[model samples]
Target chain A: MSIMRLLLVEDNARLASLIREGLDRQGFAVDWCESVAGAEHALKINAYDLMLLDLGLPDGEGLDLVRKLRRAKLMLPILILTARGGLDDRVLGLDAGADDYLIKPFQIPELAARCRALLRRPGASLGTTLIVGNISLDTAERTVMVGGHTIEATPREVSLLERLLRRAGHVVAKPALEGALYSMDAEVTPNALEACMSRLRKRLNAAAADVQIRTVHGVGYALFAPVSTDG
Target chain B: MDKAGNRKTGPTGPTLFRQIALRLSGFTLLFAAMDVAIVVVTYSSQPESLAQELLSLEAERVQSATDTDPDYLAGPPGADRWSARYIDDLGEIAGASVGSANGGRLMDWTRRERIAGGYRITGVRSVVRHGKQHWLLMQFEGDGIRPYAPVILDEIVQHVAVPLIPLSTLLLIFNIVAVRRVLKPLRQAEAEVDALDPDNGFHRLSEVTEPREVNTLVRAVNRALMRLDEAMAMLRSFTANAAHELRTPLSIMQLSLDRLPPGEVRDELQADTQHMTRLVEQMLDLAQADALAPELLEQVDLADIGREVVAAMAPKAFADHRDLQFACHGNTIVLGHAEAITRIYRNLIDNALKHAPGQTAIDVIAGPGPQLSVRDHGAGIADEDLPRLFDRFWRKDRRKTDGAGLGLGIVQKLAQVHGGTAMVENAADGGAVFRVTFLAAEPAKPA
Candidate 1:
């Protein structure tokens, strides 16, 4: 499999290097730029899977770049890394066509999970029913079964499993799952997303599913299907 | 002279309208009194002049009668030259002299001449007597003092007194209307100033109409407002710049800390970073809340916000072995922005969880005014601490809690933005209740 590539536009040298190191450890080839001008040059030359942008750039604002790329009709997924407060930058960046936003001082694992979630949206040709070892999920039927026996699940659980099954091997950020489960207008309870994931993990385990939900501490969750040993 | 003095000494003691009315009434009364005094003085001195005029007319009549009657003035019948006599202008003696024989010893009084002592000169000319012109002259000498004050008073009452009442009444009515017109702008300015909210410090006094007096006052007030607006803007910008600069480095520190390996040392560092992050975030929130304009608010459902916050904090409550529940009495609609109201609820719940000990249950109650109160079953707030609970960076036990002491301050500010207030008190059942009340919006119409 080809290595997944990411472009990071950040001005802060220490923060940019740390994030690059962290994503590189997660098996991503990240190209870093310090300004919007440099980012534009990199984008013109390279075909990247996704772009992680910083809003406060030395040469120009990250939002301006997002707008420029979107205006050019580029379909690349862009996630904003902003130090701005929630009231302003978050709303404006999303309105400007950013796929997601992570506030600064965020965990490295969380950023990795978000990148994985963004990458999973494309190139998944597994059809409506996802099979990860013995665990099978039918998106159309909104049902989950292990070894051909159905396990009872709430609607919320069914939707969560569908999201997890799509990115079966990759970790999904808590906020990404939260966004999937609730509409923008819905008020999500604190730790509500974690509680839902916990319940789903218990249900999948009780049903003797082959896959297990593994939690990435200070990050999110991932569905791991153990390698088969019965050769 | 001192109306626009220092604010404490200004005419705020009474309503502007009343002050203007009193001044107008005072001027009117002074003018009216002067008018009355002028009339009385002029009328009072008229009696003496009237007596002199009568004496002059008698002298003129006597001179004209003597000229007409050549024999009567020579010595009428048995009259001597020194005897008091009356002569008609037709050369005939008309009647006995009104003076006593002793009057002859007095000085002769002539027409237009002054009578020295106790005597009065009297004369009458026949304006049309018996179809013949006749003038009579006589002199009286016993007691010249006769009461003419009554006659003068009768003249004054007949002419001047009749119109004085209605004229003064009209003057008074005109004074009142004129005073009100002159003070109309001042009244309006007063009302406008009363309604001016320091929260929206940019507003200025409206322009006053012509008549340079009112314009001067209005201009001064507007100038003061402009200065106040500039000062407030400077302060606000300073706060905004300081907050932004401070948050940048804090964000970098937090991001760097996130890259460390998971361990006790890392955990401790992360906790400190979280504490710093919260302080920065709260400072921003507090500033934003303080700067929020009242007109920008909208209808918000406190119950809905409360329920969501309780649900969101449910996991934390569970982690701490506590129960968090929400109860609503009725429709809790308040006039405020939903985001701000939501933050208020989040802060209250967080404050409760931090302060309440022993895994106590936190109950959130929502009621009318769309009021929301968070009750925590912990040691109640100290009596001395209640007043300062909403003060910025004030904590009862700063070392015991992880809060930056800005959460309640933000809550208080948000409540004020909504045209409401925030209060905290110890509950009777050994806990503390933090309540926020907002202005009630219009009732929702039925679908």
Candidate 2:
């Protein structure tokens, strides 16, 4: 991956500068602007791969910019940054033509990962068999396998694992998992979730898989793709 | 003031209004008593003074009689009743004979005699001047006009009664008026205090035109209002700051999860997002609740909200292999916001299902306050843990669980906002019970 140019529009100079500095260290060139007007002018004057926008601005909200960009039919990736993470706000951000969204005070790595992933999205295949190393979950068969051993799973458990196996090395939150598990038929408890994950993790480990599922405290799950020790 | 009466500052046990009233009435009573005492003592002795004056006038009349010559002393002037004494040797009325009206001889005599019906019988007593004898005088006696009792009494009344009557009456009127005038400000201050509202209705009683006695009170009230205003301002700022700090990270975590590699990874991210969202929302709710103005209140049904929450939680319960059931006292309506009651039920059900083992029965009840309880066949909280359950982020086990710790705290907050309360206890039949209660509306009487 080459260094990508990012346009960061945020009214708060301190946070914008900090994010820019962090992203710069992460090998992305960030052009910072203080308002929507500045951002619009910058977009007209230059070409960029992605735009990072803070929704709180003196001139306009980030969502409004996303809307305007969408109306103008600009194809650049727009990630909305907002302090209000309300459900309606999240829905509104995505609905307004934002390619992705991030909440404030984000970790440099998480922000970087999202930015990289969003840039990669347009060129990626939706139907590709997601693979990391030798452990493979075949979408066609909805079966998980590591080194020729078929992993046995309940139909629901298979579905749950299939969703995770398809997106290896990304953080998955709980509600997203809930949506996939049951559709208004059953309610799941935290304990139930723990139980499901425990059984799933054991099944995967039993197949002598190289990777493991990691729990992120106060957050959700991380599918860790094992790295070659010699790296 | 202390027992030593040092400065005597601040509000006393008795209000200043009462003290002033007591003082006013005390002075009024004291003045009334003094006026009465003066009237009684003077009234009791007036007769003695009048009698003395009358006697002196009679003595002068006797002198006049003797001075006119003993032969001329035939009858008393303004004759009435008089006394006389006969002496062994007659004392001269300065060389004139005297007559007495009535007398008794004991020794030397002191008498005022009437000469109207007398023959020079020892004359009106004066001094003896013959034959070395200490004599008293006799006087003739008759009833014509005594001229003493009425005349002298008239003079006394004309002088003393006229002066004392106006003085006592003026003092009494002045005392009453002064006492009442002094109490006017206190009465106004008391009325102002009574008019105060517990929910910030009034700040201070204006005392620009009030008496000096209550100026301290006005100033104290003003200071208290200032402090209250400062406290409220601080609370508002705290709410805003907390909301900003807490909501920002939660939003970030949630937003970052979007476009998450859609599969198990995304699913885990979504769970994290939900946990973070729940925490953020609970914090926001707490902040909003503290700043709530009661005037924004609207009528809402707790029972309906309870049912709605139970419905919402049922899917989650089924996912966890738990059964959520609700029994209600039908039509259990209360006046409050539906969302708050909904939050109460959400937290209660979330709590019950979160902790309970799979396939356990969870029962929810809504009724006329105190009767509503959410029963979970989960591990019941210990007696000691029950008190701390409503505390924010306080879980009985320190183990970091998949769920946020703010659920029950939100329930308690909603309960407070509804003018009700929430509590938890272990059921006798083996379960944890969460009970929310609103004040039951008074039952309608027979029409």
Candidate 3:
């Protein structure tokens, strides 16, 4: 499998560097640009799996590029990363052809989870069933199995497991995971998504799943193959 | 500006131009009607006098004729166009000419009698002709001598028509121009009031050109504006203070935590900062949405906004094994701020997604009430919880911490600011439905 490459278009140098380092540690290569013009130049010379676009740029509004790219019929998934977290701004970003929206002061894990979700789209050259170590999820069937033994999971748990397995070994954002585990129409209590995740984790461990889901403090959840310390 | 003094309904009844025009027209019509009545009265009161004049002329003509010839039964030929009659006191037809009236043969002499060419004038007189009593009734073409008042009136009208018609017209035009000029300052005051912009800052209405009465109104309006300006300034400061005091530390902590190595400790710190940041941002948004003025409202398509929000959140819904659908039958337009309306959709959709059962489809529908309603398929909300659902920081389960519990409160506030209402109710089968209704926009006019 080839490693996914991403383009980050943001004006803030510090935030750009932090996001770049974080994604680099997540087994992806990220190319950073600080302006719309620079980002355009990078896109012309190289291919990227996704582009994290910031709305406010030095030269112009970032949405202009989104409009231009959509006009050109370029099928690249553009995720909007901006300090503008207003509801209208989110709608505008999505209407302007952005695939995802993340407000400023966002967590690296959430950003990573969004990138994973976008990469796992059908045309992104990724498989349907997500696998990490011995655990696998068939997104089509909403099923989860470990060590070739099908584990009993509610549909909600399977959906949650699907999200964690897709971004295996990397922190999956809590909000993103919650979004994945329940319908927005559900009357979920506060942190109820977390409660559901805890139950799913226990079920996976009870089934002796080789992969273990780890909570990354306030960040999110990560699934990784446990180290064999018996040697 | 004493409220009791301004309660005079007469002052507000009509414009000066209208009042003057109406009075002048009414006065002109009254004079014209009086002139007509005078002519009618004068002509009607003089019929007896006209008959007496004709009788004396006939007597003179007959007496002279008898002296020339005592048996004269008619006046001399061509003496006058009027034909005279001679009758004895016993009321017998004494003599008659080819067309002369026979007075003794008349049935009623008190009233004017019709003759061949014109009317017959009858008069009773004992004329001593040959020492005998005789009555003379004159029949003539009295059409030649009409009533005197009509002739006088005709003369009067001819003399006055040229000048009076133009004079009244000039009076009417002058009244219009003078009234308009007098009211110009009041109109100027009205225009100034219309142009005042509260958003631009404090602008006192101009009292310079306004009449004293209008100046009072200007002062009252300016006073109200001052109160609004003060309130706006306070709100501005509150937002500024909140921004400076809360966001700075949150930003600093988030940036500092960014440098921490990848671990559970750093992750927890980051999540806490994220939560705090969300709360601060939402608080500010709620304040802004609540304080939006009516003038800031805009025309927007509710369905298009719904579709965009649902499309934006569809991935999250899909990941949760739930379906998000937007159903709109027709144009759902409303007058509202785009930001406030968008927040309404975002918060409602978030609530529905979080509260409903897993794998349930959530539908965002543009309803016939010109409202946007988000319907879920999970169990409906409890009757007790419905009332407090929109209260700040109120939650059915306090232990759940996905949100600061301000989302619904902000939704209600935003709806209220747009002159709309937010309502929640249970669907027929199950699940909770959240609805926000707005003022429908005027339909698009044809070009």
Q: Tens digit of lDDT per residue, candidate 3, span B47-107?
A: 6554454454445656667755322444322222455555554344334222333433222
Candidate 3 stretches with Cα past 4 Å from truth are: A126-128, A132-145, A150-231, B1-252, B255-272, B287-342, B345-409, B422-447
Using lDDT as the measure, which candidate wins?
A: 3
| Candidate number with greatest DockQ | 1
Tell me, by TM-score, which candidate is best. Answer: 1
Clashes of 2: 48
- Residue A52's lDDT within candidate 2 is 91
lDDT of each: 0.72, 0.64, 0.72
lDDT of 2 by residue, B1-447 (tens): 154553336356975445655666676557655655564456446633433344434444444554344334433345443454434544346555435423232212233333546322223333433333333344434443343335445455655456665765676567667767777776776677766654343457667454665677678777887788787767755765676667555544554564356799888877777766666666766655555555545655566666556655554454455666666665576666655566677777877777776788888787745346788887677777777888887877767656557788777776776677888888887879888877555564578
CA displacement after TM-score superposition, residue B350 of candidate 2 (Å): 4.0
Instruction: Please provide, for model 1 over B308-405, each residue's C-alpha lDDT reduced to its tens digit, 9 standing for 90 to 100.
Output: 66655664565566777777777788888877887888899899998889888888888845688999999999898889999999887867548889
TM-score of chain A of each: 0.63, 0.61, 0.65
- Could you tell which candidate, 1 or 2, scores higher by lDDT? 1
Reference-based TM-score of each model: 0.67, 0.45, 0.45
